[model samples]
Target: MAHRAASGWPGVTAALAGRLAKLDLYHPRDLLLHLPLRYEDETRLTPIAAAQPGFAAQVEGEVAACEVSLRPRRQLVVRVRDASGTLVARWLHFYPAQQKLLASGRRVRLFGEVRAGFFGAEMVHPRVRAVSAEDGLPEALTPVYPTTAGVAQTTLRRLIDHALASQPLEDHLPDDLRRTLGLPAFADALRLLHHPPPDVPASVLEDRQHPAWRRIKFEELLAQQISLRRAYLARRAKTAPAMAGSGRLVRALVDALPFALTGAQRRAWAEISADLALPHPMQRLLMGDVGSGKTIVAALAMLQAVDAGWQAALMAPTEILAEQHWQKLAAWLAPLGLEVAWLSGSRAKRARAAELARLASGELRLVVGTHALIEDPVMLPRLGLAVVDEQHRFGVRQRLALREKGGAGAISPHLLMMSATPIPRTLAMSHYADLDVSVLDELPPGRSPVRTKLVSEARRDEVIARLRAACLAGRQAYWVCPLIEESETLQLQAAQKTYAALCEALPELRIGLLHGRLKAADKSATMAAFAAGELHLLVATTVIEVGVDVPNASLMVIEHAERFGLAQLHQLRGRVGRGSAESVCILLYAQPLSPAGRARLKVIYEHSDGFAIAREDLRIRGPGEFVGARQSGLPLLRYADLEADADLLEAARQVADTLLRDHPSAAAALMARWLGGREGLLRA
Candidate 1:
C-alpha cells in the first residue's frame, strides 16, 4: 500500500503503506461495472464426520503434525485433528520456503475440493491459508474476483475493502435532489449494493424496478442520444448527389440473377439509396441476422458508389472472407463491365504493386482485401464508399486506419458497415452510439427453416454415420471442431483429434481440415474445394462462422456444441440452408451438460431466430463476452448495468443531443473537461 514508484507507472500514485486498500482495480470503471459473475451462498460448516466429496464447507481443526513431499508436484501435508479423526490437508503450488511454516504446527483454514483418498479423508491440492480473525470475506457468501497473474484474490479483496472504507464518497443525490427523486445519497447506494444485509431493501435488491434506477438509466441514454444527434445534425449540413442505379449497371446483373432479389433485399436497397442521396457521408450499420441477404445489400451499395464514377473498397477481417466476397461480387458485377481488383497478404508482390497502382490511378472500381486494405502506403484516388464486413471485428482503430488510406484529402469516404451479429438495444446505445442502424429483419419468402436437434456424445457416432451416408448420397456437410488443437489440461476435448478420427472412419469421403493456424491461402483453398464438390465433408475450427457460403452444405455437425456461445452457433448454422436444400443442424454435446449450456441448446433447438437468440444471449451471459470488450471498446459498468439502466441511457442521449444542437462550443467544452482534457484539445 505504500506510495512508491511502480514500474512503467510514472504518473500513478498509491495509498499509504498502512491504509486498508481496495483491490488494485484494473479498470476504474470496472469496479462500477463489475457486475457479479455468480454468487455462491452454498457454504455450510461441517464436522469432520460429515465431510464428504462434492461439497464446499468451512472446517476448523487442531494442527497435529506437518510434513512435505515432492512425488508428483511440490506439496506440504498437514495432519489436522478433528473431533472424529485426523485428516491430511494437502497444499500444492506454493513457495519452497513454505516448508519452514509446515514445521511451525499452526492451525489454518482450508478451502477447495474434499475427496476421499485411499487411506482416509483428504483435501487434494486444496487452496489453503492461515485465517485471520478479522478477515473481510463474508462467512456464507464470499465473492471470488477475477485477477491478473500477480494479483491474488485476497489482495484484490483488500484493495476493494480500502476503496470502500476510505475513498471520498459522492452523494450523487443531495438532500434536495434525494427528496425530488426519492433516492438515497451516493454513499448509501454504494453500501447498499456492496454490503447489503440479508434482509435487503426491496429497492436495493432489484434496482431495475426502482424509480431511481429509471432516472439513472435515462441519464445514460440521453447522453448517448444527444451525442449521436449532434453528430448526425452536423453531418447533415453537407449534401451528397444522389446517383440512382441506372440499368446501365444493373441490366447485365439483373439478367444474370438466378434468383430474384427478395422483398427484404429491395427494402434494404431503398434504404441505402436514400443514404446515398444525402450530401453527408453515410455512417450506417447494416444489421442483418445470418442468411438475411446482407451481402447483396452491400453489392448494391458498392454499385451506387461506382455509378457515381468514384472508386469503392470493401474491407474484411480475414483473407478467406475477403477472397470469398471478391469472387462472388466479381462474378455478378464484373460481367456488367465493372472492373474489380483483389489485394491481400497472399497476393504476390508484383500483383499487389499492380493493384496499388490501379487504385492510385482510379482504374479499379471496387477492391476487396483484409487488413491489407488499410495499410498506410495504399492509395485510393477517389474512394467514394468503404464497406466493412463483420463490422464488430474491426474497432475504432481499424476503421480509422482504413479512413486514412483515403489520403489527407478534402473529405473522408462514406462508410457502410455490415454485421450479422444482432446487438441488443442496451448495447447499441453504449457501443455503437455513433452509427445509424438498419435492421434486415425479414427473410426471403419460401426459405425453409432449418431443423435443429441436440444430441449427446453417446450418439455422436450415430450422427457421424448419418453424415457419412448423406455425403455418400452426393450431399455436402460441415463437421465443426471445438478448439484449434489438443490440450493436456483442458479435460474438455479438441477438434484436430476429432478430424483425424473422422478421416480414418470415413475413408471414402473427401475430408478437409480448416483452423486458424493455417495460412489464409490454404484455408481459402480448402473452403473452395468444399464449395466446388471436391470435398464432401469439411472438418474445421470455427473459422467458417462468419460468412463462408456453401449452399450444397445441407448438414451442419457442430461437435462439443455446448462449448460455443449462442451467437456463434447461430452463425455456423447459417452456413448451411443457403441453397434449395432442406438443411439440418446437429449439435453434439458431452454428457451431463451444464444448466446454462442446456438453456443455450434448448433455445436454438426450439427456435432459429437470430435476434431472439442474441437477446437471450445478452440476458444470460450479461454484457461481457457478448460483444466482447476488445470488439466494442466499451467500458465495463460496475454499478450500472446497461440492461438495468436503459432509461438512464435514453436520458443521457437526450441531454447530449439538446446541448450539442443549441451550443456546439459549449457542449464540446463540457465534454472536454469531463473527459479530463483542456477545452478544444481533444478531437473526439
Candidate 2:
C-alpha cells in the first residue's frame, strides 16, 4: 500500500501529490497558508448596457445567436442580449463543449471585461455558464489562487477550504499583544482573507490595506525579526579566539602605505578592531562603494589575526578577484616578512599540495584564494579570521564551510563579509540586522569622478572612434561586453567578436580578450598585460566586474549596458576614475528599451552615489532579489512591502525583541509556525 500524504487528505494520488509538491504544498498546514492572488466578483450581475469598458463585470443574458466565423480568424462568436442591450462574445480559441453550452436561446451568465470590438460591444473569451431565471448568484467573490500546471484554481480553492475546515487556527501572539497592536485574532484574519464578504471594498482587499492583511504582514515581519535576532544571539554565545594584537603589524602596514587612510577607512578599521577583541565570534559586514578602499581595512583585520599568532584566509567569488587580492596582499605583506599563500582550482598539483601542507602545519598564517579554500584538503589549523570579498556571490553553505575550517575544535573563526554593493538603509535593517555593519561612505582624495554618457547603439561608430582616440592618447580603455559567446535568444555583442572587430577597426592599438571561458593562466596574463600598460585596450566580459583595477585605464565602454544591474554598472564604472585623469564611462544601449531597462539607465545616468543608486535599485527589484535572499537562506516576505510597510516592520522589530526577552515560548512558536525547517540556515 502507498503511504498517505502528510496532509492526511484522501484521494491525493501519486501524480496529484507530485503536482502539489511543485507549489510547496505538502501538509494540510501548507494549504492554509497558501493565500489567493486575487478575487473575481460574481455576487451580483450588471446590465449589458451599464457595463463599462476596461472593467470586469458579470452579466446575465440570452444567446440570441451563436456560430463559428472565419472572417479574420477561426473563432466562435456569440451574440449575447439582455433587456437593455446586446453584446458580442468572441473566442479565438474554443472547445466543442463550450460552443454547445453557449448555443442560441441559452440563458447564460458571463463574467469578463467589456470592450468596443469591430462588431459591437464585446467580451473576448468571457466565462459563460448556462443559468435559469431562478438561479441564484454566488454569495461571495471567487478566489483565484497561484498554482502550477496540472492543478487548476478550482482544485486549489477546494484544497484550501478543506484545510481551513480541518485544521485548527490558533493565535501565535499573546492576547494582550494582539489587542495592543489593534489586530484581529489569527483565525479571524485567515478566514476573512480566504473568503472575504461582498460588502468589503475590492480596493482595500486587493491593495492589502485591509486589517487582515495588516495582521498577516505584521506576523510575517515579526517571525523574520525573531529568526534574525535569535541567530545574532546564538552567534554571540559561540566561542572564538580574542585576536587582540599588540598594534605592531597594523601600525607598520599603515605607516608603510603610500597613501594615507581616509577618515572613513580609519573609523571602519576601528570598528573591526573592537570586534576582533571580543572573546565571542565576530560576524560583521563591511560595506563600501567602489573605490572606497575596503580591501585595506580587511587587510588590517587579517594582520591583527596574524599578529596574535592565528591564521587568516580571504575567499573571493572569482579567480581574477582572488588573484588580485593575493597579489596586492602578497606585495604589501612580503616586505613585512609575511608570505600570503594562493589557492585556486587551476594551481599546479605540486604547488597546491605544498601550500596545503604549509597551511596544515600552521606554517602559513595568511592565504587568499577562490572557493578552493573551502575544500576538505585545505586546512587552517589556527584560523582566527576569514574575510569574504563580494560575500553575496557565495551561498550560505559555502560560507559556513569556510568558517568550519578554523580547525580550532569548538572555536569558530571571525567572519568579515565585504560587499561593494551598498545595502540600502531599509534593506540593511531588515535583512542584515543579525550582523554588525560598517559603512565606508567616502572616497579617497585625488580620485576623479567619472562622467557617465548614455549612447544609443546606433552611435556605435562614434563610440569606437572615441575609444581609439583615448587609447592613442596613452590612456588605456576597457571594452566590456555582456556575453562571451553567441546566444540565440539574446542578440548581445560577444567579447570575442568585439575583440576581433576592435583589432580590425583600430589596427594600431594592441587589444586583448578576457572572459570566464579562458584558461586561468591566459586570464592572469591578459590582466597583467593590461595592468602593465602593454595592451592599449582590453575587451572583457563581467569577469572584470569587481577587482582587477588599473589606474592608467580611464575610459570604459559597456556594450548592452541596460542588461546589467544598477550595482554592477556602478562597479564597472568604478574601474575608471581611480587616477588623476578625467574618466568617461559610456553606456551603449540598444533601441526599444523596456520600461524597467529605461528606468535603470536613467537612475545610473543621473546618480553617481552608490547609496542613492542602491535605494533606487531596491525600489526597482525589491529586497529579495536585491540581497539574494534565497541564496542567503533567509525566508523572503510574502505579504509585507518593505518600503510601504516600514512602519509595521519597525513595530515588528520592537515586538520581536520584547517577545524574545520576556515571552520566549511565544517567540519560539511564532518562528516555528512561519520558518519551519528553514530557520537552521540562519546559523551561517
Candidate 3:
C-alpha cells in the first residue's frame, strides 16, 4: 500500500509522502533530534528586589486600574500597586481582549519581569497569568526549549513531557564508554536536561552544565570523529603508491603565482606529497583560515594526482564556488594540458551529458561541481583523488554517494576534506580524530596585517570621514550590512539604502550593492565588477561571507557587528586582509552593547587567530550551530561534552572502536545497547 504523505504536518503522515513536498520539517520528534538551533537558559527569572528599575522583574503587586491603552500603543497595561508604588505593568504585545480580565479588579499573578521605560519604572511587555496574589510566582525550574514556527513554546513543553513519560530507554552507547566516561545513562541525562533540579541555576546550566546541550555537542563531535575514523580505517586497509609529482609541475605553478605561496602552504604541499607516497589512500583535512591559500595547496595536491596518471575531482558546496574553482583550475592546470569539466544542476542537460561522457571516458581529468556531480548518471572512469571544499556543508550520505559514483567494484577514491573554519588543534584532534590534519598557519611575505578597530555607532561621523578619505585615496572598501533591508524595529544599516547614500555622498565614486534576495546573475555580475575595481565600494549583506574574494578591497566596515555571531563576523573580516595593501576592519556597533556582545567584539580586536576565535565561539555558543549543520532528529548526547569532557569523548571513542573492532561477537548486543541506549532512531 502507498504510504499516506504528510499533509502540512510532520509525523502526521508517513515520511515517504515528503518526497513530493519541499518541506524540511520532519516531525516534532525529528526536530528534537535535529542539532540545536541554539541553547538558552530557562533559569533567567529573578526576584523583584534584584531587578533594576530599568530591567524586567517579577514583582508581587495589587490590581489597581486594569485599563487597556488605546491611544499611544495598543497594549494591556495593568496598574499593579506594588509595595514600592502603583506601577503600570504593560503587556505590550498581548491582545486587546485580555484587558477585560485585567479590569476584574482582582489581584493576578505575572510571570514576566519589570523593564525600565522612557518615563519611569515599567515592564514594557510582560507575561501575565491570573493567580491568587497570595500564591505568588511559580517556584520550579523551567526548561526553555528550541522551537520552530507553528510549534508553540507551550506545545513543545507538552511534547517534551510526553517523550519523557512514554519513550522506552534504548541504550546506544557502549558500557565501557559509559563507565569510563563517567556519563549518566542516556535516559537519565535527558531527564536532567528536561527536568533539571531546582538547585541548578539556569545561567550556569545554560552556560555550561545543561546536559541536553552538552550531550548534543558531544554526540556531534563523536559522529564526525566516527565518520573520520571509518575513513581512516578504510584508508589503512587499502594499499596504493603515493604519486611523486616531478618538480616541473610544482615549479611551473609556483612561477605563475601572483605572489609567492606562504611557507605554511609549502609545508602543507610537502605533507600532501608525503601522504601520497604511502600505499594507503590519503584521508586528510586541510584546515586553514579564510584567504590562507588552502585552494592553492589543493591545486598542488590535484597536480600530484595528474602526475600519477590518475583523475582528480573537486566538489564544492555552491555553484558560484564551483565556477570559481573551474576558472582557477583552468588557468593553472590548463597550461599543463589538463582538462576540467564543470557540472551542476543549472547546467544545460546537453552540456551536463557531454561532461558526463568526458568524465566516463577519462578525457576530463578533473570535474568541479555542486551536488549535481553525485547524480547517478554521471560516471568517472578513473577517479583516484577526491577533494571536497567546505566539507561541513555536505552530509555523510552525500559523501557516500560520491564515493560510490564509479562503476561497480571500483576501488574507493582517496578523500581530502578542506575547511576554512580554523578549528583549534586540540578540539580538532578530539572531534576529527580519524583524519590526518594539516594547518596552513602562515601568510605570504609582504601581506599586510589588517588593522581592526571596534567603534561605537555614536562616532558615525568620524568613521564616515575616514571612509571618505580612504575612498578618495583610491582604496576600495566593503560596507557590510547585517540586514538586507530596513525594519522599523531595528536601526541597522541596509545594503540597498547604504549603497544609494554612498553613491549620493560621493558621486565620483562607483558603489555597488549585492545581497541574496537579488537575482543570482546580478549578484555575480556586481561581484565581478567589484573584483575588477570597477566599483570603489561594495555594499553587501553576509552573502559574500564566503567564496567572493577581492584582494584589492582592503577595508571592511561592518555595521551592527554586535548582532552577528563571532564566527560569522570573523568570516566577514576575512574579506579584506588578503592583498598586500594595508587593510583596516572597522566593526561599527550601536551604543550599549550587551555584555556578551561586547566580549565577542573584544575577542576580534584582541586576537586574529581563527582557531582561537573558534574555541571562544565554542565556549560562548556551545557545540550546536544556527541550523542545518546537523540533520534533524539525530539523538544527540545532552549530558556529556566532548570539549569540556574530553575524557568522556575519548572514552566513548574507545568503546565505539572496540565494539566495531569486535563485530559479529556476542558483545554486539551490549555495545549496541550502550551506543543506541536511548536513541529511538537516527536520521542519517
Candidate 4:
C-alpha cells in the first residue's frame, strides 16, 4: 500500500506542501517531532507601572496620544495607558501604516524589552499589534518554531495544531517500561512541550529539564541507541577470519622497545587481542590522549596479524603522518626480517610500482600509507588487519573501503581505529556504542608534561628571543601559524608573511616554512629536515597538528592561538613534550579576545588533561561540531542535549537495550519514527 502524503492533511495547500517538504515534514508525525525552539509567555500582560527595566515584557493598553518627532532622528512616539500608568513607545524607523494603527484611543498589545526613559518607562521598536476588547489572549505560552524563509510562524503553528487534532499518535513505550522510567506517555509529552502550561517557568523550559522535556529527550536518545545497538549486533553476524597468532612478532617488537608499556597499554592490548581472536572482525576504537602510546598498541596489532601469515595495512589521513609511521615501523620491522612497504600519492612512480608488486604478491607483510592505500590501483591480496590512525580524518566510506580490500569470498579484515583526542564517557556510550572501546588512559614512562601559557601579542619579541635562546641551547622550536581557511591564497600569504618576519627577527637562525600548498615531495623533505634537527625553527600551519613527532623539539609558539579550537590547540601542544625534555607551549593570542576565545585559552592554560579539555570543548562547541572530525557514523541529535541530558542518555541506553531484548516490535516503531531516513545506514 502507498503511504499517504502529508499534503493530504486538511487545510494544507500545494504551495504550503512545498515549503513543508523543505523541512522534511512529509507526515503529521514529522510536524509533531519538530519541537519548538522557545515559547512566548502571552498568558497575561504586565502593567506599565510595575514593568522592570532590562526585562522583556508584554503590555496591553489604550493609546492616549501619538505623534511623529524628527529631532536628532526621525521617530514615532506614542503614549499608551491602562488602569495603572502610562509608558512611552518609540520607533526610530516607522511606516506610515504603523502611525495610523496607533491612532488616539486605539487599544494595542506590545511585547519588547522595557527601558527607563526621561519621562517614564519606554519601549523602543517593540512588537505592536492592534487589538480589540473581544480579542482573546493565549491562555498558555505560545510556541516558537524554527522556520525557513518561505514558512511563516503562524502557518507552522496552525499546521501543527491540525496535525495534533487529526493524526493519531500511539504510545510506543510499554506501560510497565514507562512506569519503570517514570516517563510520561509520548503523546502527552509532545502536547505539553508544544503548549506548556501557564504555570511552567520559562527557566524550566529553557533548561529542558521539565518532566515533559525529559520524556521527549529520552525518546529521541532511545531511538539513536536502538540504531547503534542494531548495527553492533548485525556486524557480529558477518564472517571475518580470525587472526589469532603466536606471540612471535609481538614478543620481538616488545623486546625491541627501549621502554616498557604502561599498565593501561597492557590492558587495552589484551582487550584488542581477545577481540581479534573472535570469529567476528574487531571494530574497536582505541582512544587516548596525546603521547598515551596508542601507536605502540596499533603496531602490536599489525605485527600479530602478520604473524598469522596475512598481510596488514595501516592507513593514515595525511602524507606527513603516513611517512612518520612508515619510518618508525620500518626501523622496527626490518630488524625482524619483515618487509614494510610504503605507499602514498607523493611516492615516485618507480617506488610506487615496486611497492604495488610486492603488495600484490604478498611479499610485503605490512604496508603503511595515506588515503593512497585505498586507491583502486593498490591491491592487498592476503590482507588480514586494517588499522586507521587519526581515524577522525577519514570518513566512514573511506574506512569501509579499506576494510573491503579484504576482498569478496574472504573474511573481512579485522579493523582497529586509533584517536588521540579523548572522547567523553557520554559521547562514547551513545556515539560509539557499536564499537568496543579501549582507552589508553596513561602516558608512557619518561614522557614529560607540556606546560601551556597564554601570552599577548605584545610579547612577540620576548617570545622570539626565547625561541632563539632555546635554539642556541641545541633545542628546536615550532612556530605554527593559524590553519589555512577557505581562501588558500590569503592563508598561504599570511603564513609566508609570518615566516618572513620570523626570519628577519632571527637572522642568525635557520627557519623553514611548511603548509598544504607545498608539493608532496617537498613537504616530506621539509618535514624530514625538521625532524633530523637540520632546521632550528620550523614555521608551519595546522597541517603539523597531527602525527608530527620530534623528541628534541622542546618549544612551540602558536601565532593567533585564539583562532584555533581547544581540541586543535591540544593536538598541536601534543606535538611537543614527546621527549624526555620538559616542553613549553606558548599561546600567542591577539588583543581583544572574544569571551569564548578567552575562555578557551584560559581552559587550555590551566588543564593539560585531554579528557577534561575535550569535555570543555564539547561544552563550548556543542556536540554537533565536536564529533564532526570523526566520521563516527553517529547521527546528529535534534532534541537531545548531550551535556544537559547526560543522565537521561544513560537511562535511554538501558531502555533501548531492554526494548530490543524484550519488545522488539515496539523498538522497531521507535527507531522507525525517529531515525526514519537513516535506517538504511544502520543495516549491515
Instruction: List per-prediction Cα lDDT, in the order shown.
Output: 0.69, 0.91, 0.68, 0.87
Model 1, C-alpha of 418: deviation from truth (Å): 0.7
Expressed as tens digits, the lDDT of each residue in 597-680 for candidate 2 is 899999999999999999999999999899898678888888899888888889999999999999999899888777777676
lDDT of 4 by residue, 1-684 (tens): 133366566777888877887787877778888888888888888998999999988999999999998876889999999999999999998899999999999999998899999888999999899999899888779888998878988889998988887777789899988998899998898898888888998778877888988988999999989999988888888777677899898999999998899999999999998888788878899999988988889999998888888888999998888888889888888888887899988788998998898888888879999999999988888888899998877887888889877653558788999999899888887777778999988888778899988889998999999999999999999999875567888778989999999999999998999998899889988998998999999999888989898999999999999988999999999999999998999999998999998999989999999999999998888877888823655567887888788888889889988999999999999987887766554311
Question: Predictions ranked by lDDT, top down?
Answer: 2, 4, 1, 3
| Angstrom error at residue 487, model 3 | 12
Q: Which portions of model 2 miss their true places by more than 4 Å?
A: 1-7, 62-80, 92-107, 484-493
Per TM-score, the best of the predicted structures is 2
Candidate 2 or 1, higher lDDT: 2
- Please give, for residues 410-476, the per-residue lDDT of candidate 3 as tens digits: 3656778888888754555554566688998876566678889999889877887888788879888
State which candidate, 1 or 4, has the greater lDDT.
4
10 residues in a row with least lDDT, candidate 3: 675-684
Each prediction's TM-score against the native?
0.72, 0.94, 0.66, 0.93
What lDDT tens digits, residue by residue, belong to model 1 across residues 315-396?
Answer: 9997778888999898888678887789897788998998899898888878988989987668986787888898778876
Error of 4 at 408 (Å): 3.3
| TM-score between model 4 and native | 0.93
